[model samples]
Target: MKVKPLKDNILVKMIENEETSPNGIILTGAARGESNLAEVIETPEIFGEDQEILLRGETVMVTPHCGTEVKVDGETYRMVSYHDILAVFEK
Candidate 1:
């Protein structure tokens, strides 16, 4: 099952960070740092407006509560708009 986002929408797969801190303190789900970071999955061939700086396979930090979550082929993913993408991370 492949996904292709429309307009400025982007498909992202959440990247969960470790549950423990550097100091060895185990963090609970509520205590975990907010991880808006995710890997870009797919985007439209051409954007409706300005060309988006994001591309498939890139990791990005998105705005919290900016996207809709979905389950595809038993895998969880989020569909976020271009404006919701706050920052792109280098591999």
Candidate 2:
């Protein structure tokens, strides 16, 4: 929340797979895997961290659905390459 990513650097908040469906259908957490798509909220500070350059807006989707996972502020998230991004969705 306090940290801001730089150019070409996307801060993604990985979404967790649903344990229960909207129709009252329930599924065990182990039954479903983690989500690959992540929401890009902010871009890091340019000239810092030393990276290529990505935008601040939009989501950076990942591929193979098996990337890297990160935990921030007691929350679980993920970080994947921009090239691995599949698509962006509106939250």
Candidate 3:
């Protein structure tokens, strides 16, 4: 399924964080707290030269409690504004 965000809105999927303790104990994101990190699923097209381009599959950090949650085909997604995005991770 394809989903396109409107205007400066971006579609993202939450990325879960997993950590392993020194004793080999695994800890999930839920065990600690909800993660603010997300992967860009769909980015709004830029029509102006001043707008920055965000590519799909890029990991991004968003502001806490920002964006609207959405569900598509049993999959969860978040629609966040461009201003709410903090940083993008480089490969």
Candidate 4:
């Protein structure tokens, strides 16, 4: 099926996480008790440093915890209301 995001909704392609560091640093998945940072690979033209995310990776970070999740080209993303969106970054 074909789907299109509504106003303020964006489609993003998720980048797979790296299993090892470029310097050959081996990193293994942590246990449940271990805290890991969420890895998000975004395009420079989409979102930049110091700018609030209005829409990204097809998902919108609305109110820090509220937003709709979406998918594009078999990749997961998100959607958000315009008010929930902060800004759209483009280079």
Candidate order, lDDT descending = 3, 1, 2, 4
Candidate 4 structure lDDT? 0.41
Candidate with top TM-score is: 1
The TM-score between candidate 3 and the true structure equals: 0.83
**Tens digits of per-residue lDDT for model 1 on 1-91?**
8888888889999888779998999998878866889999888788866666577899899998779998999999999999898888887
Residue pairs with colliding backbones in model 3 are none
Residue 50, model 1: lDDT of: 60
**lDDT per residue (tens digit) for residues 1-91 in model 3:** 7888888899999986658756788877567567799999998766356668889899999998889999999999999998899999999
Q: Which ranges in model 1 have alpha carbons more than 4 Å from their true place?
A: none
Task: Report the C-alpha lDDT of model 4 over 1-91, residue by residue, as the tens digit.
Answer: 4555554443333233466767877667742222211222232333335544433334322345434556556666544344554433343
Candidate 2 vs candidate 3: the lDDT winner is 3
Model 3: CA > 4 A from native: 19-30
lDDT-better candidate, 3 vs 4: 3
Query: What's the TM-score of every candidate structure?
Result: 0.89, 0.57, 0.83, 0.36
lDDT of 1: 0.86
lDDT values, one for every candidate = 0.86, 0.59, 0.87, 0.41
Ranking of models by TM-score: 1, 3, 2, 4
* Model 2 per-residue lDDT tens digits across residues 1-91: 4655434445577756787877868877666666665666555555445444555556555675654566677876555555566666554
